[model samples]
Target chain A: MPHREKTRILLVDDVPENLLALEALIRRDDVVVHKAASGDAALELLLAHDFALAILDVQMPGMDGFELAEFMRGTEKTKHIPIVFVTAGGRELNYAFKGYESGAVDFLHKPLDAHTVKSKVNVFVDLYRQSKVLKHQLETLERNRQEQEALLQELTETQEELRKAITIRDEFMSIASHELKTPLTSLKLQIQLRQRYLKKGDASAFTIDKIAKMVESDDRQIQRLIRLIDDMLDISRIRSGRLTVHPATFDLSELVHDVVDRFSEQLAAAGCTVTLTVPGPVVGYWDHFRVEQVVINLLTNAMRYGAGKPVTIVLEAGDGRARLSVRDEGIGIAEEHQARIFQQFERVVSASQIGGLGLGLYIVDQIVRAHGGSIRVESALGKGSTFIVELPVEGNRASDAS
Target chain B: MQANTLLIVEDDPDIRACLEEIMVSEGFEVLTAAHGREALQALQSAQTLPALILLDLTMPVMDGPQFLAELASGRWPEAWQRIPVLVLTAISEPFLAGGVAEVVRKPVDIGVLIDAVARHLPVSLS
Candidate 1:
């Protein structure tokens, strides 16, 4: 959008006819010309709108142009506006000299020329128009810069807030782990003792059966709580920027296997077909735990959202980095929400119904970035989605596989 | 398995509680004292000799080094040297090699704590 601009000129002359002529001559679609028969009227006009230039007649009935020019020079507002005088043509040099002394920019003798008047007027008008354009552009640029600075400031504040939140979360996880340890420890002991006693008793007894069911439920709940606390800690490390990757020589194939093995139970429970492919023994030095975590999150998210859909795991060497990708044939990301897929709390609408806290991709992206790596996502609605991770791998070794 | 008694000496309540919980879970009869003075008194007066002492580096009264100095200097119970001393503090300043047996860190991980204690405890559970 262009700047809003308007040019205004104040014309002062005792002869009404002369004022009308000047007005009709200088009128253009872009300029607004105002006429004042008296010096007081001209001053009032100057007070209202900033004039581009003022035209004054020396031989006036009340206050002459020289007096008006002097008055204009005295006041702050009208002073900067250039003043040009109309002379009566006697002691031309003297009249011109006094005009200059009273703040006149130029002088024109009476019996005005039609062409000279139009041409001179056009020069000042063009100057006024150019300056107005420049001023408006400057104001716009300043406004845009201020808005940009405000946005950057807001971003900085949000980053700090997120940091604080991660700290709080870490504290909470550590505390929860401490609190839950006592009960879990006691329960584990109690259950072990109960198992010992049951082994000595009848294996098929009704009361034994009942006790077994209760024990199973209790054990599952304990396991779940432990998993929750552990997840919170890992995610906290990723969020708080405390998670560091220790790059070692390792096999990417083995990494994929570990990830798959960790979620084998969940995959079976979800009854999803999972395929793994890797020619990896790909070498890289990355914080193994964090990279492993990124893969785990991607796979877990896929399993939760993929439903009965097939999920593919691919590990490949690319551009000096070990790459791992998880692609799922499930509901795909929408066009509008794809850009912010890695942002926290932003679950794509397609996966909104899934049981997720929407932190998986955010954590994944963070973990990848920490490895000095990058992640990409490709999706088409209703077809499927693929999430890819690339990382530098130089010195790595495979973790033991069972 | 015979449960050996363990003494914990530290200042922070949160860290103290966390340590006790870990030791108790690992089947040790645990006793806790907050600082070095109280720990020394406990050592002088407790009915049973502890199997190990988990010491913290920084504290208000008679810090870890001072307490260790008094014990290791001379004329002290032989049990002091026998019991494995695991220093658990955040300080990373390198001292003379083998100043203490092992140094665990702050923000204790349960697995690490259990493993450290189990490794240092001399008598294996039957």
Candidate 2:
């Protein structure tokens, strides 16, 4: 997939003249050549750099060609490189004996044959090229293995983070439950104590007022805590695929009316009005309870953003899909947040003034999908936003491919 | 220093405040803290060391396991070691109190909390 490292060929000869002569013999691209003038120099070169082969001179001062060849063969690093000797006017048996004993692959005579050197060197070069390819392949595999290990490590880290998140969630649940219990206990106690005190003429005006305030405060706290716990449990059930749906055919218009009736107080508190317009009857199959949950979540969202503006719920039917649209006039969804609003655990950025866990739209999306339906949101930053949920009439029987 | 007082260690305010009210109305001197670190600190400096510690499983700084780890090695101040810690938590894993002395579940009745404290040692109401 990428480029390769160059090949290095080292030539060793005692005489400078022979070294120069040998260097000119072979010229090829993608090959690097190094020459050494003596056995010691050749050994130094071998230590400094890796070579494919050492071309040695048979005649030398301190280290004989045969001795150098033996040294190259003995040492661990230099042993693998092939050795070829250059000699002149020697007996055939002596030459053959020296070559084989000293570990020379072959000997070339001093009246240096250029073609012969080129041909033999080519053979070693080809061998060098093949080994390089194998080595490169090994390196590539190693790199890929390292990358895979890093990815696995990252995945493990993510899993650990998720585990911590779940633990925090569980801890929050326990604390929330305990908190709810305390207030409920206080409320019951206050109510009982005040009723007894009144019945027994033991209730002073001060005592009665105190107990009343206590009951009111504790009741509010209990309600808030209960709602939080319910939301948490709902998300947990939805995520684990444990939430069940009770499907039935119902008039979509009636369901919307009930949802509106339930949310009347919330709408008033939020200073928002609601309006609904629908056809006489749009028949739809859905889990009524879950559909109500979805409707409430959408209404809450509308109330939050629509703030005093009328949230309109319009139901229409066409192409075997029943469409439900909720329009809000408050600060509409920004383009960036619109994309992510349907993602689990995503909250609107910088909207902390409104308290939410960012799971409402996500839950809505899931409910819509389970009914073999789709939802689309259209919004601009400053203008009002519209969310349309379209459901198939026969959601339960729809084929997966469709 | 009184020998009988109930200790409660929890990071959450509502949980701590609720438990404090429960214990105080039950006529026991109650001590409270937000986490294991502060609990240990309070334990070390208290004019009256508590007879029992109601420990939470998780907290802000050091958690239940870390506290137990520290306590098991006996690295805590000597006075702190002798306190019988009742590991009050929502987690049912009583084994989380491996090195600690006792265990109790949260959202338990105030009467149950009092009995748990009374069973270990007499608590000071004075």
Candidate 3:
């Protein structure tokens, strides 16, 4: 799968005949020979290609072997190329020392020995190939290390997220059990009281009235249990990504009014007064049923948190967008808790104080976003909160309506 | 008459009413409060201290723990201190550390609740 390139050797001499002789002597199956007639020509070849070894003639017309070697040593590109100097001059110690000082690996005497030159060239070529392999392996190792570190970081984050999810789930289960038991206890007591009255044969008007009241109380508790179960099912649907929205053209103001009217009894019980401010009909293509759910959730939240306070709902449509705001004058959310309130199983108030699965706002957020809208809150401690939802009028209508 | 009095402290109106009716039919005088704070207020204004208190653990404004703490803090009248508390809760473990006569878990059997109340009530009152 991986292609291996041939090792290259450069032969440099001013004389063409000497270049041919050197090239012929060093040419092999694994190596490619490049012949350059002068130092300038050799430098040109070196710049264009990578060579395992360079054989240079000490005596040249210009830019001789020592000068070329010194120049190559100064340049980063050619500095590591092993140089072997070949000269027809005397076997003098000073010439050899000068060759070594100029970055030559070996110096050969005149009238060249073919066997010795080949062996020396082979040694330098082998060293160059080994170093290249080592460098490649080092690069591979570094890359593997970096990838491993990234995977480890991802694993750690995923583990932390999983831990938090488990804790929330445990807390939710505990709260759910408690919530279920409270109404169940009341329901059982109501039934037992009715049975006791019936066994006593007490058919008086007073007994009848008390029984009627207990029956009504039982109905309320049963409704609460049903709502809790419904909320749990909604959470499952949301988690499975199966929540569907069926949209149609409708007046947003009318829908808001209708939802508010449905909560009139609860609002009165909480001592909360709601004021609706809608100047005109604001039409939108959205899921009417889902939108009703959102309004109901917001209103219920307002009544629960804004007990004995005034709540206001304002609807305005302009510039291809519809905006609805629900403002409550009650105990407000803290700045840090505003964002967390929209997450599943998260509540700003303690579970003991408030009774719910804490899935209302999360389901509301999901439905609003599915309609190509955004929801946000503005609140301060003890000042109250306003939940604003803005939906696009035209865009995402087709998909939503479908 | 004072010794037969019993107090029911619970937030749920339906449950509180049901308990009160049950206790009244059992020949005991029942006083009710919506929460711990209300219970304390009722105790402060009572002409005769209740012989026993049926306390629910979780409630808004103030809970069972707060009520027990206030009762033991030596601020209430001496007669209120001797009244035994019967804890009613849905939690697995008892939330109260001390000053509780019994722990009754919900959804509690009416028979068991009534029996516990009778056992904890002062013999003079019963």
Give the best candidate by TM-score.
3
Better of 1 and 2 by lDDT: 2
Cα lDDT tens digits, model 1, A1-402, are 323557777889998999898888777777788899988888888888888888888777787787898888879887777777777666554454343654438766678777887777778877776777887899999999999999999999999999988975664444444335433433553454445446668454237675665455456446545555656665768667676557766677787897788667657655577898888488677777777778878887787667667889888887677777899987888777787888765676422124344556877787777666789888888878899888866422233111
- Per residue, candidate 3 scores C-alpha lDDT tens digits across A124-202 of 9888888888888888999999999999999999999999989989888888888889999999887777677777876
What TM-score does the first chain of candidate 1 have?
Answer: 0.50
Residue-by-residue lDDT tens digits, candidate 2, B9-93: 8754545666776676556688887667778787877888887788876553466666767776778777667777777765444
Q: Chain A only: TM-score of every candidate?
A: 0.50, 0.57, 0.85
Worst 10 residues of 1 chain A by lDDT: A393-402
Off by over 4 Å in 2: A1-106, A110-230, A349-352, A400-402, B1-126
lDDT score for residue A351 of model 2: 20
Instruction: For candidate 1, report its TM-score.
Output: 0.46
Docking class of 3: medium
Order the candidate numbers by DockQ, best to worst: 3, 2, 1
- Share of reference contacts kept by candidate 1: 0.00
- lDDT tens digits, residue span A1-402, model 2: 312665667777667877777787766776678887778877898888877666777778888777887787779998787777778756573454343754437777768778898888888877766776788899999999999999999999999999988976765554455445544544544444445456668546246676565555565557556655666777788879976666888878788888898668657756688879888788887888777777778887898667668898998998988899999987887898887889865656432134355567888888888887898899998688899998887765556335
Better of 1 and 3 by DockQ: 3
Worst 10 residues of 2 chain A by lDDT: A349-358
